[model samples]
Target: MNTESVDAFQARVAKHAALADPARLRIVDLLTLGDFSPTELQAELGMPSNLLSHHLRTLEGAGLATRHRSEADRRRSYIRLAAGALEGLAPGVEHGATRVLFVCTRNSARSQLAAALWQQVSEIPSTSAGTRPADRIAQGAIDVARRHGLGLADLPPRRLDQVAGVGDFVVTVCDNAHEELTILGGVHWSVPDPLRNNTEEAFEAAFTDISRRVNDLAPRVHAA
Candidate 1:
């Protein structure tokens, strides 16, 4: 094999090797659902922090996963599957729209993240509104979005009525809002609201969850 081919072969081998440990494999599986901080992973897996850290480090070195420091809290870190990472190892599901709308209770956090994330990947434009709009966007949410490189500054929060209407692809990002509105033919994702505690960790967790959902849903929205 040529030098380039040999390097590619070795990289694949390294990726495979990184998953050899059952703990690492479980970490990857959890991340597939949504990004989680090291603390969250420990709580979910009931594993030691040191052990989880070791596996996470190995996964990062193998180009299988990556971690991002929270803009809200420097001490906290979120681990997510790297783009194009483990592409061939995992089965791909083949899975779009226009003027997509994201909704939540306050239009403060979850919905905003979803709309911004969708904007990045989908050809369709997106907007966010809340069933009962808050006076302002949560500072923690703004920090998280900034970390993701989305400039959410000065974006005014809107009420659901302001943006809701037929022919709009409405997606509710809160369980309560989804259950209440029961938007006809609208998609719903039960995302946690970080504003409950108004903590940086809460916002970061919400951002990670919303980011994953938005990316996953982009294709379907664009195809519509």
Candidate 2:
């Protein structure tokens, strides 16, 4: 085999080795949908802090997971699956929700695109909101949507509390919104803010990321 193929095989072997333990596998399953802090993982797993830390370190060393400081609370950190870490892995468990509510800091780009993409793929009913909303839907988002043959509605951005309802599956699409929210039972995707660059490439990248996530999640979530 070529060097590239050999390297790829070794990386896959390492990832599989890292997940050999039941505790580590469970941690990966929890992170398949959302980010979680050590405290939260500890609580969920009922595992001691020391043991949890060891597993997190092993996953990180294997390049299967990452830990980032919270954008809201600098002292706290969240653990998330590394990008493409679960490629070729089985899908996680199913979820039931009345609707899917996508959220971001400004509700200008990421959340809007996510909601639109989700609607195209699933019948679970989806909408979007912001923690601190922008004055209008971003032009960059509109352009990207048009390129993808999707329409971003002309509706004004809404605040989270105004639109979110019980049974809604909340997905925070940006790091800022995810860190700011203390909400329980929500998913967090650490997608970068594309609007910061305000370029076609940036918006397209954001759209692509959300599109993959929507496709991955749509089948797993069913209307309650």
Candidate 3:
């Protein structure tokens, strides 16, 4: 190999070296599902706190993960898969057996963003609704969607009663909505309601989370 080519290969090797350990690989897998605080990671991985931090540091060096402090709780740091970190391993192809219905309390943010993200990532039909539809979608949700290259200019908050049986696959994005719509028989994300915080960052975080989960959930949603 030419000197330049050899250097490139070496760099590639170095980047992937961080993932050579099995524990790091598992950390990457968990981050794919959603962002987790160090405490949460320790509980999930049953690893020592200091060791988990070491793995996260390695991931950061390799550009495979990023960390952010929660705006509400600065003492907590959340670790998420970095931008494009999962592109090499993301799920492909939608399960077309059942249309997907995204649900939350207000349908102002989480469910709305989830459905928009699902549309961008999957071919299967998807939409959003709420337990108690807001009079209007949150402007922060709209702003964040636009920033993420999604348009929510016309999508409105829809009531759950109007869409209870609209789809065979129902994914609830809030704890309350999950309990209220238990008969829907799909997964519940337990995602926080961004409107309660009403910050640009909060809305962006909500969008990022819903987008990640929706992308991951698409491939496994085949109807029974």
Candidate 4:
């Protein structure tokens, strides 16, 4: 190969190298679908906050992901995959297959929205579950999805362990759940719980955050 080709090849190698860890891969998978806070990622992947933060920093440094603060709540920040990070990973490949799992304390709001939004935005296979499954999907989540032209009518809550089989990635959408669960197979993202408060304002804020994350993740999931 020419020097230019060799340089491109090595750069790609480094990108994949950064993602080589099973834990880091899981983190990419989670971010591919939505923006998550570091705290939420720690809970979902069941890793120490320090460890999760380290992995996130690595991903950011490698240009595999990006982080931004929520406009509604400055205290909270969300992370998503970097643009074009997944591109050229496979030449001439138009689509890649991926399976994503969204986790939260209750599979009612954030996780539910994530799963539905992934399905709507990309062709990748997706599912949502909770450490503690909710009785039903949160109404606010459903409403927000409807308004956004995404549908959530058929989705039902499920327990995390009930999702049998291998997933390319797993994401935690709640802080407590992210801290509580470990042994998830793939990338871990820490997204805050949207249903922690029942207020309309809180629900709208959660919806906006989820929507932005879903959009950011569509490219990676579809590329996979």
Candidate 5:
């Protein structure tokens, strides 16, 4: 190959190489829609901090991703896809139908709302589960969805393991879940749970917060 061809070939080879590992591929899948910090990635992927850090560094080195320290909290850094990485990875593919998984300590509230709103707004495939599954979906969650014209009648509280196989991205909707459960191989979002108050107003606020996060996530979910 000529010099230019050789470099082009090498770039493509590296991009594909970066995705060779299951964990790394999962990271790419998650970042295709948004950014995450190292700590967040560790919890979401359920890997050791050092291992997750190494993988993230590798991805960033390959120009597939970028990381920046949080302005509000310098100790934290967020990782996101490099500007053109998605287009290069899956040229011409439509991303509107991506699948996502929402998680919380209990599947009754925050995660449930996230999944329902995501499905309603993006028209994408989504599911909700808990690290410690709840016996039933929260009525507050149901009420919030109904207020937004989304239905939760058919949705059931599920365990993380049950939906693991179908997740393109896995987001933890509360700090407790984000800190406690070790997420394995999926995108992570750290959202606070609304069930703490157990009040109708609190549920409404939680629903609103989740809806906003879901909207921000829609582009990344649908980006090809």
Candidate 6:
């Protein structure tokens, strides 16, 4: 085999080897939906910190997971799957939802885009809201949406309490909203806040992340 093919084969072998342990496999599953701080992951898995660290190192070495410092909190770091690392991996369980509620600290960007994208792929009803509603949607978000053939200019930012109801499947699309809200049965997506940078590139990246997640989730969620 050629050198490039040998390297590709070795990488796949490393990934499978890393997931050989049940603990490491579980960590990948948890990170599939959202980014988690090591502490949060420890809490979820009830694993010792040292062991979790070992697992994280293994996943990183395998090119399956990566770390990012929190934009909201500088001291904290979160772990997430590498982009496209799970392309052919098994999907998570299917679920039922009367409605899908997308949430963020501000209803201006990630959540709004997610709700709109969900509408494109799923028959289930969806809406966007915020923990702390902004007076207006971000112009960056609006422009990105228009570029993607989705409309956000006419949508008003709503508070979570105002729009969310029982039977709604909640998806928190930002770190702040996920950490701030004590949501029952809510899924979290750690899409970075684009308003912090307010650049076209930042907004486009956020839109792409939310769009992929919404598409992945929409098919798994059925109307109840």
Judging by lDDT against the true structure, name the best candidate: 2
Select the stronger candidate by TM-score from 5 and 6: 6
Residues 95-206, candidate 2, lDDT per residue (tens digit)? Answer: 9999999999899899999999999999889999999999999999999999989999778999998998999999998878876775646788877688778999999899
Report the number of backbone clashes for model 6: 0
TM-score of each: 0.57, 0.87, 0.60, 0.57, 0.56, 0.92
Instruction: Estimate candidate 1's RMSD in Å.
Output: 9.0
Estimate candidate 4's alpha-carbon lDDT, on a 0 to 1 scale.
0.70
Where does candidate 6 have its weakest 10-residue lDDT segment?
A: 181-190
- Report clashes for each candidate as comma-separated counts: 7, 0, 0, 15, 5, 0
lDDT, candidate 2, at 54: 98
Which lDDT values do the candidates have, in the order given?
Answer: 0.74, 0.87, 0.74, 0.70, 0.71, 0.85
Write down the lDDT that model 6 would get. 0.85
Off by over 4 Å in 6: 1-4, 183-185
Cα distance off (Å), candidate 3, residue 36: 1.3
- What is candidate 6's TM-score against the reference? 0.92
Query: For model 1, what is the C-alpha lDDT against the true structure?
Result: 0.74
Q: By TM-score, is 3 or 6 better? A: 6
Worst 10 residues of 4 by lDDT: 88-97
User: What is the lDDT for 23 in model 4?
Assistant: 93
